[model samples]
Target: MNLIEQLKTILSEEQVTTNDVILEQHSHDESYHTPHLPDVVVFPNTTEEVSKVLQFANDNKIPVVPFGLGSSLEGHVVPEYGGISLDMSQMNQVLEIRNQDFLVRVQPGVTRTQVNKELNKHGLFFSVDPGADATLGGMAATNASGTTSVRYGIMRDQVRDLEVVLADGTVIHTGGLSAKSSSGLHLNGLMVGSEGTLGIITELTLRVFGIPEKITAARATFPTIQNAVDAVVAVMSAGIPMARIELVDTRSIQQVNTSLETTFEEAPTLFLEFHGSEAALQYDVAFTQDILKDYNCMNFAFEQDSKARNALWELRHNLAYSFIHSAPGKKLMVTDASVPINELPSAILHSRAKIEEMNLDAAIVGHVGDGNYHVLMMIDLSNPYEIEQAKILNEHIVNFALSKGGTCTGEHGVGIGKAKYQALEHGAAYEVMKSIKKTLDPNNILNPGKIFRDINE
Candidate 1:
């Protein structure tokens, strides 16, 4: 039987397709990276089906790239070497909610928003909000973090256990349900950020948090980008427990105001959120206000109304879309670089300078609380000059961050876009990663050309 026929036997015929539209949909993610279509797309509805598919692919030496919602900023889901695009959406289900254990067991296809909706009923919530309603499997693969990462930690921290299917069809549990462990080699850490290079994630067990008694959101405007970033440093140094602290530069604020039709101050601003008891939030807000004054904070506004608070975050989360909307017929190339807390001010300033020097249409924004920032650049993909300039700016920003002991990618995984920097960022550790990849996937049939340029290389 042919590949499609063979896959149909594992899944229902309706679950396999080679339609042009379906292939196009699975070809790329929300990234500027070049896309490639898989020869066939397969939707596995269960862990056993996934295992069978992998077992067949391993024996035949065919590449299998897992697909989520395709909301990834990097080209993590692109089928660089066409074979099988494993769509996990069919398996999406909130399998179990261990409310007493503060954990939720879910299939790989469940989205963060979907999980939260179910968790809300139990007065619990998942904290890793990566702006997009990304699938839990994809989030775990990339080790994604967002505004809340400053306090709650990243995706890896929330993952209690993972039911993964290896390249050769062997199933393994990376970690157990215990709160902590020193039992083995820490496979959970290895698989969480592996980006589908080592294995395919079939299911996940994640830690969840109870709804806070009170949640307050505030925005603080600053005279300059440096001042705003400095204020972030001050607030973090003060040990204020902030649920979210995001920085939006003047250009980005302008875009937000223009797009959302809201009269926000056109200055470098910090969007802050605090979660705690009503009395505790009041004290933290007061203390945070006092500290903001030291950094020339122009205006400090408290968004007490829940509707207004949601609007505020909506504006922040939609900042990227605003840039995209403003620039028609252009693609966005975002640079994700994270630096040490103390180096954030200079790092952001340097990025702003580079953007100006290149005269590119870009904006500065970040989850500044954790020293990670992104430069959103809109470039004409068809124009070679524009693409080259964007690439140069990305290299400059990444090199600067590396110099300061930061990472080329803070939350976005090392997909094709950031693969070139793997050796530079990890050094001798890069070799160790390649060894692990080879050991797990000898045929290099799983998500080829990711993490490293090629497993052999």
Candidate 2:
């Protein structure tokens, strides 16, 4: 039987859509890549339904693309090969919230904001925030990290267990609530950041932290990027336990100031947040300010008022949107590269020089406390030379990071855009990845043309 016929029999007509409108919607993600329409879009409401869909697709050698909120900056869910786009929106139900255990079980389609809203009622919250209100599944798929990552690590660290549907529709539980494990191969590690190539995450058990009693946010400005990075390095080395430490270059600051309609010094700025008791928070800020003195901090300001602090972080969180607002019609090609903690300053300095030499209008910003940063370049997609310049710059940056024992991507996974650098970054590990991919997806139907391309082709 044909793939469409099999799908029709197993799922309701509304669950499967061949409509151009739905296909078009699922074709693209938040990236620079052109959209490719999927042959069909399926909304599976249950884990069993998803497994059934995957099983049929696997049996028929059909490509299956697991989709979350489509917030991925990389083209991980673009449906490039034109197969089944498995939409998980309908499955967005909070399955369970174990308050005593400080864990929550959620369906793949639930958004981070939604999780937070619900968890707020219980006085518990998930710490991983990528600033996009991205789905937990997509965050896990990308192993995403953001400002808070400096204190609470990334999505991978928060995941306690995953109910992943394998390529062959086998449902497997990777890990449980217990912290450490000395078992066999880490299926959880394999599934997280696999970019939907390994399997589809149906349900996730995530760690939740108690909402801090007091939150103090501050903004510090420096004359140079080096000073900003140096201050962050000092803070980290001092073990201050900052909840958020983000670096925004001068160019990005201008963009945010214009977009946010707020006056900020057009210099490298660091937004920081500390979470603790009232007294401890005060002491932390004082100590942080003292440390910043050595870096020649141009300005240091803190917000104790809830409303003002929210406004401050709102600007920092939405700084990426400032790039959009500044460029009006231009699309951004962002690079999330990370180097060793000590090497971050040099790495960012190198990137700044390359951008100037290339004469590209780009902004550098990131959760720099983790040695991870993104170069958000506003590219005129119509200009061939400009696109070529971006590719060259991206290659140069990736090569630089790889040479310094850094990763091609610190947060963004190797979707189609960064897949080319996989071999160089992974080497023999790349072959091992391919072997695993082949073992799990022999037909190469799950997210085809992603992570690894056809060797001969």
Top model number, TM-score: 1
TM-score of 1: 0.99
Write down the RMSD of candidate 2 (Cα, Å).
1.3
Candidate 2 structure quality by residue, lDDT tens digits, 1-457? 6666679888998898888898888998889988899999999989999889989988888889988888888899999888899998898999899999999999999999999999999999899988898888999999998879989989889988999998889999999988779988888888899989988999999999999998988899998999999999999999998999999899988887787777888999999999989999888899999999999998998787999998887887787777876777788899889999999999999999999998888889988989999998888899998889998998888999999999999998888888998888889989989999989888887898878875325
Q: Tens digits of per-residue lDDT for model 1 on 58-101?
A: 99999999999998888999998899999999889999999999
The TM-score values for the models, in the order shown, are 0.99, 0.97
The per-model lDDT (C-alpha) reads 0.93, 0.89
Looking at model 1, residue 407 earns an lDDT score of: 96
Task: Write down the TM-score for model 2.
Answer: 0.97
Inter-residue clash pairs, candidate 2: none
List where candidate 1 sits over 4 angstroms from the true fold. none
Error of 2 at 309 (Å): 1.7
Error of 1 at 264 (Å): 0.9
